[model samples]
Target: MEPAANVLDLNQLRRSCSSCALYELCLPAGIGVDDLDRLDATVKDKRALDRGDMLYREGDPFEALYVVRSGALKTFVQNEAGDVQILGFHLPGEILGFDALATNLHVSQAEALERSSICELPYAKLQQVTSEVPALHRQLMRVISREVVEEHRHLVMMGRQQAQEQLASFLRSLADRYQRLHRDGSALNLPMSRYDIANYLGLVVETVSRLFSRMEEMGVLQVNRKSVRILRPELLAALCRSDAAPRRKDAG
Candidate 1:
């Protein structure tokens, strides 16, 4: 007869990165179990957070790379007058702390949008591990490069894409992210509210809502409360690529 499994203190058990759902997405492809074990050793704990709990604050000294294990998070920046601007929504399989990598100081704050858990990878330890595993070094560079490319894409979106087109692209992006995390892409769970979406998209809340309604009416997208479904993903995708090329405005 088998004994009952220990249920208490499961969080303290040795975590296997190979068992993680995001293993394929975040970690290097085709790495063996030994590599996975070594990578797992770099992460210390899976920290749980409540909604609105801060992962890190602006000006906090950078220490480790944070990977979203579950739920969602948002990064924001504050102006001199203390007004906050939503920067981006981060999902599982995504890494935070890239913005702080160069300066060793965070210029923005990351907060949980819902009940969340994250794996902590200490930077110094990661650097040492990378020396032992060259694949990880390349994987790290690829992850950082994706962030840079996304930022440049956003600059282009805000500069050239029309309001409706921008909203469509944003919805598509959310769908893609959720899909990549092994979630249902047809329907979305928007943890952040419309105001946060508007703030990120450079649009007002009313405009953002109106655009969603317009897209639904056009049979391109559908929204039910916080759940959005792309009715015609192909058409929506077309709209995203149909935007005019960004043009530089001359300072008069």
Candidate 2:
């Protein structure tokens, strides 16, 4: 048998990138073991956070990218009037810190929505490694492009006037993201509060609450506080595409 020290090292290797639950989603497709090893070396320790913790504040210098290993975070910016506008809700395996790439300073603040763990990849070291691995460079571009696309999609989502449609689309989007993680699409646990959802959707908190109650009454979903179970996904899909105005009760 191998020495105890050697056996410990072997166990560490087994838990590296190749063995990560999100390896396929977070890393470049078809990347080899050697490349994976090199990339894994740049990752710092997993940082733990509790609810309401600030991962990074706006204007902080960006030194690394963060991947949500578990739980969730939300990024937001505040206006001069102190009104907060949530930029995005980030889930597991998704990368953050791209907002700083252009200016070298974070434009938004990132906060943990619940207990979470994040993998930090120092950008300078990451760049050096990616330069030696062409596939890694391409993957970086793909992640950046994805961030741009999501920003555009969010802008469009906020432009719609119907509260019901907006709420439905938001739920559907979360369900789709959950499905991507190989979880149940019909079940969702919202870490962000209803007020946060309202802010993100460009509606008032009262309207958001009313919309959820209406959807539950309509048999579209069952809401038990933060947990929601989608019952009529088809109806939600229709709400997203429909041009009809919301009922009088939802006019809050």
Candidate 3:
């Protein structure tokens, strides 16, 4: 067993992590260099997973809070019928296992969508660190708040949007997230397959394929297999706006 106090090196991790787009968000709102060093000292372990690897299964005992160091993860719950309902896609800088904080059992399984890395902060040590460091508490609060907002957005998407609108919204949101990760927002290299995307958007795989074809035909985007280039982002945005009026109504 690894020693409880085996912490990652602060300066080395920071230096390696400086180029990542998530660095600013991963640290607290007002964290300085010295504070970051302290926070880094608390990270107990780092692990990497390949695409299609499972990080944790549902019902596993939750022991640590995980922060995505790079790549993406899909978190989902399995129903009694064994159908999977994707909860969310976690990008780098995002934290996982919070839902289990109160109950101690993981509510969903976290699966890697691509080659990914994560930093594990042991829950006991994390609690101690938060007690000692005000910034860490603030950072955790911010993470929780963001999750709430994202959940609300997902609810709205599922409740209100049509299938096409939902698909467009998902793609646009993905582009924005990709941009935040310092990747090309306009050009997307989809890590998830059409089936995965279909499941996530609550649509059939055929519907997802059709929507992609339609978007391409409308000159809104160019698609080839898993790669997409947004040709007309404004038009794509319009397609995503289910509440917006038709062109004639807007003209009037």
Candidate 4:
């Protein structure tokens, strides 16, 4: 017998929680209709940009926290000597642009890694909605807090982890984030290039390439250019824990 036909309308979802498919990931669940309506009125969605476009550069006056509606973006910055550092990658349902929350000026730049569109939550209006909805206010705080934790996690990895451990952590992170976005946890697309991954993980590009190859040999991962399949997710995740790194000759 043939498999049952998949039947689901993709167009029925609205920008707000009642009908939005990303309700669980994009917005805090259980917000009342009034709050949802307020959010729908304030959100500016579907703003598009091409690859290589800078969505917002450093020093630009900050206005809103942008959410990926489709496609992908990269947040990075240049040092005084003009070398670029990749900060993070944002996928659909991810919120970014909090750099200016306190000082009112952007410190890093956000650029499109592919043809992308984002929904802007104007900060001024977001502040108002948060005031009305206590849950939403707490939700915003949680988002900002996660970004802070991610920074600290990277610092720890860079300071103590070996190259394989760092790369393993990186792959596991990507797979986990994609899982949160409702994509397959076992196999997914890596929107950013190896260079970006290397910068974020504090490894050289060649070392990153070699790590992927070795992981495949160990049955931990399978890589085909930009796509990575986690063949041994448990082992890969274990590599993320302190001191659990697999012993290998080139682990240095």
Q: Which candidate's TM-score is highest?
A: 2
Candidate 2 differs from the real structure by a C-alpha RMSD in angstroms, to one decimal, of 2.8
Tens digit of per-residue lDDT, candidate 3, span 1-252? 633446765545444433345777676666666666566667765789999999898899989988898888999999999999898988888899887877899989999999998888888878887877788788789889989888898888877546778778888998898887777999988878898888887778887888888788889899999899999989889887876513322111
**Candidate 1 lDDT tens digits, 55-86:** 99999999999999899999999989998888
Count clashing residue pairs per candidate.
0, 0, 0, 0
Per-prediction TM-score: 0.89, 0.92, 0.86, 0.90
lDDT per residue as tens, model 2, 215-248: 8988989999999999988888888864653556
**lDDT against the true structure, each candidate:** 0.83, 0.88, 0.80, 0.83
**TM-score, prediction 2:** 0.92
> 2 or 4: which has the higher lDDT?
2
Model 3 lDDT-worst window of ten: 243-252
Q: In candidate 2, which residue pairs get closer than 3 Å at backbone N, Cα or C atoms, i.e. clash?
A: none
RMSD of each: 4.7, 2.8, 5.9, 5.2
| Over 4 Å off, model 1 | 1-14, 242-252
Comparing 1 and 3 on TM-score, the stronger one: 1
Error of 4 at 204 (Å): 0.7
| lDDT rank order | 2, 4, 1, 3
